[model samples]
Structures are given as structure tokens and as C-alpha cells.
Target: MKLLLTAISGLLMGLTTAPFSASYLAWIALIPLWLFTISHKTTSLTPGVKNKLKIRNIIVNEKTLIAFIWGFAYHGFSLFWITGIHPMTWMGVPWLFSLLIAIFCWLFITIWGAILVTLWSVIFRLFIGSKEIGNSPLPPLTKGGEEQGMGIKKKTWLNNNLFQSISRVVFGVAVWCLLELLWNQGDLWWTSLSYTQSPNNLTILQLTKLSGYSTVTAAIVAINGIFAESIFVLGVNKKQFSLLILTGTLGIILLHLGGFYLYKQPLINDLSKEINVGIIQGNIPNTIKLYASGWRKAIEGYTNGYEKLSNQKVDLIITPETALPFDVEYIIKNSSFYSAILKQKVPVILGAFGSEKRSYTNSLFMMTETGNILSRFDKVKLVPLGEYIPFEDILGKIINRLSPLDSRLIAGTSDQIFETPFGQAITGICYESAFSEHFRRQANAGGQFILTASNNAHYSEIMPAQHHAQDVIRAIETDRWMARATNTGYSAIVNPKGDTLWISEMNTYQLHQGTIYPRNSQTLYVKWGDWLTIILTILSGILWIIDN
Candidate 1:
């Protein structure tokens, strides 16, 4: 029954994410599971029954199975759309076999996320379920058949219950954020609570300007922990519960109010250049994007698209990742393609695959009006299994049993900044926008703008919108205006504050021309990446240590 409730809570949490976007539910979604973690009420041992009463507290440091089950439901609901990348899509395999492989990949992601959640649960359980914590000033909790109110004569101990509850909440937020940072080390760091709260809630989103998303995530999780503790003590604390209720209730209100104040502060200055940019949403379908027969039509589409955009006389024109589907050198050697870029005498930034002696890189570069390659920024962060699969020697055999090609691509060096006609711009290819630090590094290095090229053709409808929202978070964190060029529509221009200045419709080919304002002042997050979040996380750990 407990496991069932935990799974339900997980689904409720997933619903607050994309495709549903009922983000208001995130505040209350985790309360059920959190309460389950701390529930250890002792039933009355009246004369009616003695040994039949079963306690409900979770064991110390081994909260794996329930945590895994809960996380499985949560991540499975949120990431089910990833099945679109099954071997059948690009491999042309059997339908039934492809469906099974997709399901297997989806299940692998669910299990991987479940393990991280389980680690958090185990560490939190270890702290709150220890015997050394009894000497603390907090009230003596019931333990080993000890009465709750028997040894709580001291006033210092009376407040232990309050401190313990808050400490439990702190422990949860700290450990959860710890794992969040860990996964961000480049393996399945997709759905942090901070990323989930984008464009929908600007007040919470403002927190990103001062401190990166990790701080906002910690604040939200801590609030969930408080709510869980309050709900668990609902009927039992009727006598002296007013103070506890006030503290918990006021804590939530104050947190949001503080966030709102920060959001409304005069944070960004409008001192930078106003860029007149045009982006092409090529709307290329993945079915034949790489096919030999479709090469003529693909080249014609981009050439004609550039002609239409050149008429607008925009300062910079952008194209999605791999807009040039063929080999870049071969395509550039053709005078017909170079004529389209050279005719307008304007700079164009487009995505293409480049090769350097047997090694290929997913790269973005500046194409000058004279048909010269100005500067190139190869993709620093590569997607796993999608762009380049890991352990290809072992997993490649199983993957290529159905698919055709399974090879590794080369990774670019750390220092990359593309100097374009419109100032120095930091370029992020595909999922690289999801990592906030990628932008921060370039922003600190004097890159004034962000240009991200993504191929959203591979995923479902929900994916483009989700990807757009993540980019909005990046603009807020770095205080830099950003432009997104996607292959399959939903190209957009976003301001420093994450407002969508101009957005193209999905699944439709169009050129978006708009005026976007950049920022000269660096945000606190851009100046010092994740420093505030790291400090608070360490403070939470110290609180956990003091209580234990």
C-alpha cells in the first residue's frame, strides 16, 4: 500500500512537467512520498492486541526498493517520448523489434534516474535515523519503545522537534541537489526541479539570475519537505501546534515573497546592442534528411529560405543544427550554395558536420559574405546514444545487430567562442543548451550573445516546446539575449529575461525576423557559476550533521 502511494506521488510529480505543464502541482506533489519517509507512529499497546501491531518506519540507509519504484513511475511518465529514437526510426528494422528496443531504452533511463533518487533516500535516511542524534538539543523523538514526552523536560529539547523537522527537510533538499549536480556531470541530467519551473513562473525563474537553477530547486524541495512534515502532524498536534504551523506556513510565504522581490529588482541593464536577426526553421523531416535522393530538395529549400530572409536585411541569419545535411566541404565547394550566402553581403551562422582526418565533429560556424569560413565552434557537449553512444565496443554489437552505423564522433576542445558579425556569440549545438555552465563560461569570456542550433526533428511534438523552455532558462541565468534555430520549427528569439520576443510555429517552415535586446551587465550566476547553490547545499549538509 505504501509503495502504491509512492508511485502515485511520482506520477503526480511527472504531470507537473512538460506536455502537461501543470507546474503549480509541483509544490504539493512530493508531500505524499515525503510523509511516508518520516512516518513512524507507535500504535497504542492496549490489552486488545500486543504483538500484532506493526510499525511503519523505513529502515536506515537502505531505502532502495521503494525509492526505485517511485522514481521508475516518475521518470517513465516524463521520458516516455524518448522511445521515438528506437532503432526502427533510423535503422529501418522490424516494427515489433524496434518497439521492443525503444521500450528497453526508455526503461533504462527510468532505472538510471531511479538509482539517483534511491541514493538520495539512502543518505537522508542514514542521517535522520541515527542513534548519535539523541544528544542534540532537539526534542527526544520516540525510539526503542521510549515514550515521546517522557524525557523532554528541558526547554532546549522541546524545540528539538522543530529543528529536527526542518533538518529533515534540509537533508532532503541537500542530498537531492547533490545528486542533481552529480548527474549534471554529463549523464541523464534532464529534469531538475529548477528546469521544470521555466516561463511558467517568472518569480521563481528570477532566482536563476542571482543564483543558478540549483538554488531554486533546493528552495522548492525544502518547501515540499516542510509541507510533508506539517501534513503528517495534522491531527496529532492539536494542542501546541499553532506555533509549528505558523513557522511552516510562514516559511513558504516568505520564500516566495523573497523570490518575487528578487525577480522584480532592477537586475539587467539595457546597455547592449539591439540585434536585427533572422532565423530559418527549415522544417526538415528526419525520414529523408540524410537520404541521397533528398539532397537536391534540401539544398533548394535552404537557398530559397536564405533569399527570403536576405530581403529582410537582417544583420545576422541563423540556421538549425546540421542544416547542411551533406558533407560540409563538398557543399561549400559548390558555387551554387556559396552564391546564396555571398549575394547578401551578410554573415550567416549555420550548423554542419565537419571532418578532420577520419574524425567528424558536429560543428557550427560563421559563413562570411565573401564565402569564407570566419570562425567555427565545434560542439563541446555531445549527447549520449543519440549523437555518440557510450561503450560502443560492447553495446555497439547489440545496437548494430539491427542498425547500420554505430561510430563515435570527436569532441571539441573546452575554449570555443565564435566571433560573428554581431559581436562574439557563444554557440551551443543541440542538448548543449541544457547545461547552464556551457553558456556561463563563454559569457565570462566576453561573449555577448547566445546562438544555439538544435535538430528537434528527431523527437515528438512535446520535445520542441520543452527544448525552447530550457533555452529560456539559459537566457535568464546568463543575462544574455539568445536565438534558437531549430530544424523542425519552433525557432524563437528570447530576451535576457526569458520573454519570447518572437517564436515560430511548430512543424511549419518560416523565417523569423525580430529585434532582440542584449545585456551588458553580467548576472550574479554568470559571474560566479553555481557558487551560491554550492554554499547553501554545504550549509544544509552541516545542519544535517549537527542534528544527527
Candidate 2:
């Protein structure tokens, strides 16, 4: 029954994130897990207690098991879309083997993501001590107040002790934020609690301008903790429940109010400098892109898109990642693509393979109106298993069969910024948008706008939508206008306020032209990076230690 409750809570939490996007569910999603953890006390050894080690082992094992169950459920539901990688016959793998690989990837990522939540539960238990905070002993009755039945005190645990409840919530939120930060450094990070409010809850989402998405994530966790604590004390103490409810309510109001204020503030003092940009979504299929037989369709789709957008005389035209699959020299020598670009007399920011010293890189190139290369930014983060195989020396023989490429692509340095005709452009290839710090650094380096090129032809609708949401958060965090161009759908334009000004349909060849301003101002998140999150984690850890 306890495991069932934990699983339900995990599912609720997962539903609050992308695809489902039930943001309100996040407020109470953790209640079931919190209730179970708060009621299950770890047995302590008294002076004459027998088999203390045995009892302790039993308690520890149970906690770990329950935590694992909850974590697995949460990540499994959230990342179920990973199974879209199946049917790898397009990549020359057998149907049975492709199904096996897809299932393996789904399980592997789910289990790997679950590890952080499991650690969060274990560490939270350690700080909570033998006696649960919800089950802490009541103090003596107030003066002139009568004792309740069975020697129970008339006064509640929170009559004059609100600090205890507040401290616990703060500590829990801090721990969660820290764990998310730790997990985000790894390869499998996709969903964060803050993203639950994105593109819908604009007020609270504005808080990312202060300290990146961690601030909003901290707010979400803190509110959930308060409600969970309140639920625990509801039957035991009505007054405490009221107080907690009020406190949680006020916290929500103040957070939204603060974010609203930030949202209303002007991002740029002068909006006079703007660039007309055209985004192209070439609905190319994965099979066509991989095989030599269908390369013409891929080229023509982008070529037509460029010609159409250039006819409109936009300041710049952008294409999806690897729109031209071949390297720079190959495209220049063997194709009329560059000549057409020069004839158009318009600058284009296109994606193609780049080579330096015979080493290949997935890169974005900014071509001048004169058909000269302006600047290029190679992808810093490569997709694992798809682009590069990790631990190749050990798993190379087996996993290499699943990989599309014969050799791994080299990673580029993060400092490479595209010097465009408009301004310094911050760019990401495909997967780098998930990392907030990467964009933050670019914004700090005087990047006025962001251009993210992606190839989402390999996945379903869910992955592309989730990818688009990540870019929205990145725009708000860095206070920059962002334009995303993808291979097969969800190409969008987002303002600094996290608003999706324009978005395209899936599996469609479309062209969208919008005006985006290039601003030099930086947000606090871009300036300080994740320092605030780190400090909050440290302070919260210290508070938990002192409280225990």
C-alpha cells in the first residue's frame, strides 16, 4: 500500500511536467510521499533494546526500496517518450534489435534519472533523524489551559513554533534544488520542476531572470513541502493547519507578485535596434537524411525555403541543424547551394558539417551576403549513443551497432560566439539547449540574441515540444530573444519574456518571419550563473544540521 501511494505521487509529479503540463498538480504531487516518509520512523536503540542492528537494517532497506519505487515511477512516466527511438530500420538495424535497443534506452535513462530522487529521499531522511518532524512531541499546555484526554497538550506543536515548519520546508526545497543541479551536470537531464510552469504560468516563470530556472524550481519545491507539512498536521492541530495554509498561500502570492514585477520590467531600454529574421522548417525524414538516395529531397526542401524567405528580403535566414549534411568544402565544390546563396544577396545562418584537421564537428555556419563564411560555432554538447558512444573501449562492440555514425564527433569550445551582421549571436546545436549555463555564459559574453538549430526528425511530437519548452526557459533566464529552427516541426520564436511569438506545425515545410531585438543588457542569472543556487543549498544544509 505504501509503495502504491509513492508511485501515485510520482505519477502526479510527472504529469505536472511537459506533454501533460498539469502545472497545478505539482503543488500536491509530493504529499503522498511526504506523508509516508513522515509517518515511518526509523527505530532507535534504547538502553535495553535487543537486535538493534537488525531493526536498523530493516528500516533502512524499507526506506531505500520505497524511495527507489517512487523515483522509478516518476522518471518512467516523464520520460516514456524515449521509446520513440524504435524502428531503427532507417539506420540499417533489424526490427527486433531496434526494439531491444529502444527498450534498453528507455529503461536505462529512467533508472539513471531515478538515482537523484532516491538520493534526495535518503539524504532527507538522514537530516530528519529518528523522530519525524510531523510526529515531534508536543510541548506542555499553555498557562491556565487544560490538558486534553490521554494527557495530550491543549496547545499544538506550532502554537509558537512556526520556525520549525518553515525551516523544514526551506531545507527540503534546498536539498531538492541541489540534487537537481548535481543531476543536470549529467547527460540524461531533461525535465525539471520549474519547467512545469513554463509557457503557461508566465508570472512565476519570470523568476528565472533572477537566478535561472533553479529559483523557480526552489519555489515549486518549497510550496509543495509547505502543503505536505500542513496535510500531516491537519487532523492533529487545526490552528497549525490554518497557519500553514495561510503561510503557503502567502508564499505563492508573493512569489507570483515578485515575478509579475520582473515580468513588467523592460528588458531593453531601447528597442530601436531590431533584425528581421526568417526561420525555415524543412520537414525532412530521418531515412531520407541518412541515405544517399534521398539527399536531393533534403537539399531541395531547404533550398526552396531559403529562396522563398530571401524573396521577402529578411535581414537573415536560418535553417535547421545539418540542413546541408555534407561538410563546408563538399557543399562549396560539388553543389550550386553556395552560388544560390550569393545570388540571393542575403545572409544565411545554416547548419552543416565542419572539418578541422580531418576531425569532423556538427556546426552552425554564418554565411555573409557575399557568400563568405562569417563565423562558425560547433556543437559543444553531442548526443550520446547517437553522435558519440560513451565508454567506447568497453561497450563499443555492442553499442556501435546502434549508433548512426561510424566515428564520434569532436566537441567544440563554448567560447565560440557567432559574429553576425546584426550582433553577437548565441547558438546551440541540438541538445545543448538543455543546459542553462551554456546560454548564460553566451549572454554574459555580450550575445544579444539566441539561435538554436535542431534536428528533431528522429523523435515524436512529445520530444520536440519538450525541446521547445527548454528553449523558452533559456530565453527567460538570459533575457534574450530566441529563434529556434528544427528539421521536422516546432520551430519557434520566443521573446525574452518566455512568450512563444510564433510556432510551426509538426512535419511541415514552413517559413516564419519575425522581428527580434538585439539587447546588450544581461540578467542577474547571466551575470552570477548558479552561484545563488549553490549558496542556497549550502545555507539550507547548515540549517538542517543545526536543526537536527
Candidate 3:
């Protein structure tokens, strides 16, 4: 029964983002998990000072396993879109064989992601989730409340519970933040829960301005913690119901106030220079995009999109990842599109393959209006397996031979920034936009605006929206206007305030023109990065230890 509740909570939490995008569901997503723990059997409260909590440490192993179950269900559902890769079978392998490989890949990632949830749950249960906080009267632990509790006014646990509850919530958020930061350094950063809030609850997404995603995540965990604590006391004191409502309202208000205040700061008229960009969505079919025979059609798709956008007087034209099908240089030197783009006298930003020292790099290039190379940004964050296989030196020999996957591209450094005529333009090829730290480095080094190019043709109907949702967080973190160009939809322009100024549709060819202003000032997150969030989490952990 507990397992089912946890799984359901995980599923509901996923619905708050991506294809469904039911943001309100996040508010009550974790209630089931909390209810299970709070309503379970436990030890009686002891009134004496210095008395131990008598917490059987109940549900020790069960909670951790339940957490795994919840995480498995959550990630499995959230990432099932990856099975879209199974179409590789059409590349040459047997259909059943490709489907099995895709299934293996999906399960592998789901299990690995579940570990982050497991770690968080275990630490919460082991450290902050102590039954004392689950059911402790604060008087004995409350400073100077020791005398009053002896007179039987001992229900003051609410006050005491507040401290523990807040600490646990902070701790819970820290665990998530820590895992996300770790993933940012790896290949899985795209799965962070911070992206789950979209369209609606961004009203409170303001905490992101002060402390990056940590504030938003902590606030979310805090809500669940408060709900659980309130449930524990609902029968003990009907008054907790009112207090919980008040506390929840105030917390939500503080978040909104902070977010709205900072969100407005970027709106003031300033001296920042602006550059107009024409974002093109070609909506190319995924079937033949990467093969040799279909390359021309893909290139022509962009050529047609350029013709539509060129006359708008846009300063530059941007295309989705690898929209050129191969490198643009080949087409420019050998094709008519070069003269067509030159006729417009505007630079072009598009994804193409670049070769370096006999190795290929998934790269984004800026071509000058006169058809000269402006700047090149080799994709620093490469997708594992999709671009290059990990442990290629050792396992590549074995896996490459057996699989139809291509494993040759190299990774660029985090310091790679493209110098545009206006200012530094940070380019996040595909999903690299999901990593806040990688994007911030370029912004800190004078990246005025962000350009994220993605190709979502490998997934089903839902992926493009989910991918775009992730970009919104990057804009909020750095206070930089973001330009998202994608293949197969949702190419958009997002302001530093986290507003989607405009977005295109799925499988539709469209052209969007927006102006981006370069930002000179930096948000607290862009300046110090995740260091402050990490420090606060450590401090919160220490406080939990001291309070316990």
C-alpha cells in the first residue's frame, strides 16, 4: 500500500511538467508519501528533558525501498520517451533487436536516476527524517519551554516541529540540489525536477533569482514537509489546520514577492544593446536527417526557411541543431544557398558537423553576412551514446562493432564561448541548456544572450515541449535573454524574466523574429554560481544535527 502511494505521488509529480504540464499537481504530489509515514504506527511521546526519542527508527528499510519504487515509477514514466531511439532498428538491425536495445537503455537510465532518489530518501530517513521530527513535542527540545511542558501544555511540538520541519525540507532540497549539480558535471542533468514547474506556478519561481534552482526546489520540498507535519498534528490539535494554512500562504507570498521583485528588475529600460534574430523551425522528418542521401533535402529545408526569414530585416538567422544536415561549409562552397544567404547580408547561426584532427565535433557555427566564418562553438556537453559512447577506448571496440551507433565526436570545454559582433553569445547545443553551471560560465565571461539549438526528432509528440521547458530555467538563472532554435518545433524566445515571448509549433515550418538585449549585470546565481546553495545546504545539515 505504501509502495503504491509513493509511486502515485511520483507519477503526479511528473505530470506537473512536460507533455501534460499540469503545474498545480505539484502542490499535492508528495502528500501520499508524507501521509504514509506520518500516519504509521510509532512510539509514545516522552515528556522528560534529555529523554531519547524512542523512535524505533521504524520503516528504516521499507522507506528506502519505497523511495526506490517511487523513483523508479517516476523516472520510468518521465523518460519513457527515450524508447523513441528504438527506431534505430530501421537503420539496419532487426525490429525486435532495436526495440530491446531501446528498452535496455531506458531501464538503465531509470534505474540510475532512481539512485538519486534513493540517496535522498535514505539520508532523509537516516538524518533529518528521524521520527522525532515526524512526531516530537518541541517543549522538551524548545529553548526555555521546558518549564511550561511539565504543566501538561506539551502540544507545543508544532512550534518545535516547525524548526525540524524546515530543516528537513531544506535538507531534502539540498539532497536534490547536490544530485543535480553532480549531474550537471555529467550527462544526466536534464532530469532535474526544477523544470517541472512551468506556465502557472512560475508566480513563485522567484526564489531562482536569489539562489538559482535551489530556492525553488527547497520551497517545493518545504511544502511537502509542511503538509506532512500538519497531517501529524491534525488530530492532535485542530488549531494546526489554521496555522498550516497561514504558514503556507506566507511562504508562497514571500516566494512571489521575491520573484516578482527580481523579475521586474530586468524590465527597466536600460542601455543594453539589442540584436534582432530570426529563429527558424524547419520541422524536418527524423527518418533520413542523418543519412547521406537525405542530406540535401534537410539542407533545402533550411534554405526554404531562410528565404522566409531573410526579408524580415532580422540581424541574423538561426536554425535547429544540425539543420544543415552536415557542415554548412560544404553547402556554402558547393551550393546556391550560400549566395541566397549572402544576398540578405545577415549572419547565420546554425548547427553542423565540424572536423578537428580527424575527429568530428557536433558544433554550432556563426557565418558572417559576407559568408565568412564568425565564430565556432564546439558542443561542450555531448549526449552519451547518441553522440559518442562512453568508455569508448575500452568498450567502444566491443559496442561499436555490435551496434549501429556512431561514436566519434569529441567534447568541447566549458570555457568555449562564441564572440558575436554584439557581445558574447553562449551556444548550448541541444540539451546543454539544461546544465545551469555550463551556461553560467559563458554568461560570467560576458555572454550577453543565450542560444540553444536542439534536435528533438528522435522522440514522440511530447519531447519538444519538455525540452523547451528546461530552457526557461536557464534564462531565469542568468538573467539573459535566450534564443531557442530547434528542429521539429517549440523554437522560442525567452526573456530574462522567464517569460516565453513566443514559440513555434510541432512539425510545422515557421519563422520567429525576436530581439535580444545583452545583459551587463549578473544575477546572484550567475556571479557566485552554485557555491552559495551548497554552503547553505551544508549549514542546514549542521543545524539538523545540532537540533536533533
Candidate 4:
């Protein structure tokens, strides 16, 4: 019954976080869902038909079940979003194969690591001696009746249930928020090191480095997990509880809805002109490149679509990353193709390759109406294993044996704001959209509008569309209008406040046209950029030390 309950809780948690843009409740949904696992742990003891029961057995079972459920929840829910990705889209394959691949990806994610750390930490705290609980090579308690250890001292200790419960709730929330924010910052680092099919390059060292960072990141997450679990079990109905939920919900909502309102307010709407930008949604299949006959058809599809939209005379014609697979130089040299850009009149921003020496970059180029390459920004953050392989010499044979044609591409430096005839725009290509720092930098570096191009088709409808929401968040964070162009769908014109002024549907070939404002300024997040997260992380660390 207990195991069944634990598993059911796992399934519920999984379902809740699976769909993209499901609800803000998903973030805190784990709180109540995890309670079932906690409940099973406390009831596992057969108390000889009575007697307040053996607390020891309860603690032990709690530790074991807690560990199992933590792993199950993190891997199950956080990675549940993976099914929406293309790599795992081969649903026709053997069930075991699909399951194994999804599990493999989740196991490596930093969130899963944090779950493990939290469960173990809790177990150690409950049953282990004070010295062991502190996990430091020092005395457990001092003359002051406070626990003391290496770089740690207990300022607060609970002898009663109420105090412990209150402490637990506060600890849990602080931990979750701290870990969430830290994970936010660490995501760029992790993506830089890990392998993905989209960016297409990562070496053995880079993969190994991902594991290393994931371990450290998980440890921090685990610390936060302890707080989360404690609160789930005992921290309900407190004054702080309402505040936690309110703040958390508001943060999540603002993340999705706030982008539009903040950007379109008196600053952008009343002052700036709503420029119509045309986004060409080129729905190119992943397998198109493999067939010789598909090349002409694919090229024609994009070119024809662009030609159709060109007639509209929009302010900017934007397309997804690698809308044209070839290098930018090749496109410019071709008079026929260059004319396509020039005839549009307004500046054109699209994803393409930029070659320098032996290295080829995943880049975005801003072209003038007269066929001039106004400015170009190379993608600094490359997806590991997808774009390029890391540690090729050593892990080459192994990686090749597992995943063939796995290679590495060179990364670009400098997040350059393209100065065009219309205005200067902050542009992020593909995976660059996920990193908040990149957008903040571009905005701070005198970018008037945020222009992002992405090829999310590799993840199919779920991830790409959900991931595209990052643009909305980016717009809100920087208080700038975000114009997003995705290869398949979810293209949108987002205001500085993080609201979607206009958005394209998912999984289709369409040319989305909308007039978007250029904010020409900055927000608190844009200026300071993750300073709040840093302060929270530092405070959490300080609290952890003090608690120990």
C-alpha cells in the first residue's frame, strides 16, 4: 500500500508538470503531491496493535521512501517535459528503448541530482547522531549549548514540534527558492557542457564537466530539498505559508504575463512606433538534409515564403535560426539571393552560418535593404554534442559508437547588437534565447529591441513552444519588446512587460506579421542581471551554515 501510494504520488507529480504552460501551480504542486510519500513513510510501522509506536522505524522508513520518491519525482516530472522533444518522438520504437532514453536524459539533469542530495541529507539529519547530522569533523555542541562544527554553528535548535515545524517550512521555502534561482544561473553552465541534438557539438570532457557541475548543483538543490520535504510534512497553515504561495505564484505569473504589460506601458507604447515585423516560419524537417532530392524543395519553400511576405513591406523580416542552412557569405555572394534581402527594403534578421578560418559559427546576420551585411553576432553558447563534440580525441570512439556523427563546432565571442537602418536590436540565435544574461547584456549594450531567432522543431511541439516562452520572460526581465521568430511556430511580438502582443501558433508553416515596439532602454533585471539570485544564494548558504 505504501509503495503503491508512493508511486501514485510520482505519477500525479509527473502529470502536473508535463504539459507546457500548464499552470503556475506546477511549481508548488510538488508540495502537496510529495505529502503522500511522506505519509506512507510515517505509517510503515506495525506498532504491535498500539503503543505510540516505534519512532525509529518511522524515521528509517521515511528516509528510504523519501529517497525513492525524491528521485522518482525529480526525474519523472522535470524530465517529463522531454517526451515533447523530437529525439524521443519515435514513439513507434520499442517501449523500453523510449523509456531508457528519456530516463537517461533526466538522470543527468541538475534537478534530479538535487533531489537525491535532499533525500540523503534528510535521512542523515533524522537518524544520524548530532556529529553525523552536522557532517563535519568537529564537536557537535559547545559550552553555549549550541552545535558547532567546521564552518558551521547552530544558532537555532528546536526541542518542540511547533518550533521545528515552523523552522522546517521556512527552511524548505528558502531552499526551494534558492535552488530554483541557482539552477537558473547554472542552466547556462550546464547547457554549455552537456550534449543536445540541436546545437550539435560536445566532447567527452565537456560531458564529464556537465556531470561535475551537476553534482555540485545537485548538492545545493539537495539542501533546498530538505527544506521542501520538511515543509510538505509539517509546515502548513502558517502565516508564512500564504506569503510563500502568493509570492511564488506571482513570480511565475509575472514571468508569463508581466512581459507585455511592462513593455507596452507609457515607456514603449506611447513613445515608440509599432513596427510591423514579418516572421517566416520555415517548417523544415530534420530528415530533409539526408535526401538529395529534398534540398531544392526545402530551399524553395523558405525562399517562396519569404518572397510572399516581402510584398507586405514590413519594417523587419525575421526568420528562425538557420532559416538558410548555408553560410552568410554564400548568401551575400549570390546576387539573386542578396536581391531577395534588398528588395524587402526593411532590415532582415535571420539565422545563418558565419565562417572564419576553419571554424564555422552558428550566427545571426542583419542585412540592409541594399544587400549590405550591416552587423553579425556569433552564437557564444553552443549546445554540447549537438553542434560540436567535446574531448573528441579520447571519447570519440565511444561517443561515435553510441551516437554516430556526433561532432563539435567552434563557439563565438561577443554578443553584438546589430545597428541597422531602422535601429539597433539585441539578437540571440537559437539556444542563446534561454540564457537571461545574454539578453540582459545585449539590452544593456544599447540594443533598442530584442530580436530572437530559434529552430525548435528538433523538440517538436512541446519543448520548442514551451521554451519559446523564454522570450516573453526575457522581454519582462529587460523591460524591452521581444520579437521572436521560430522555425515551426510560437513566434511572437512581446512587449517589455512580458505580455504577448502577438504570437504564432505551433507546428505549422506560416508567415506571422505584427507591429512591435522598440523599447530603447533597460529594466532592473537588465541592468543588475541575476543580482537578486546571487544575494539569495549567498543568504541560503549563510543560513545553511548557521543551521548546521
The best candidate by TM-score is 2
| Clash number for each model | 2, 0, 2, 36
What order do candidates take by TM-score, descending? 2, 1, 3, 4
lDDT of each: 0.73, 0.80, 0.73, 0.53
Q: State residue 479's C-alpha deviation in candidate 3, in Å.
A: 1.4
Taking all chains together, each candidate's TM-score versus the true structure is 0.89, 0.93, 0.88, 0.68
Off-target runs (Cα >4 Å) in candidate 2 are 40-60, 137-161, 267-271
Worst 10 residues of 4 by lDDT: 193-202
Model 3, global lDDT: 0.73
RMSD of each: 5.6, 3.1, 4.7, 10.7
- Candidate 4: misplaced stretches above 4 Å? 1-20, 32-72, 75-107, 110-273, 289-292, 401-407, 538-548
If the candidates were sorted by their lDDT against the true structure, best first, what order would they fall in? 2, 1, 3, 4
Local accuracy of candidate 2 as per-residue lDDT tens digits, 262-323: 88986663557778899988888887786685568777777788888899989999999998
Give the range where candidate 3 is weakest over 10 consecutive residues by summed lDDT: 49-58
Q: Could you tell me the lDDT of residue 547 within candidate 2?
A: 62
Error of 4 at 177 (Å): 4.4
> Model 2: how far is 225 from its true place, Å?
0.6
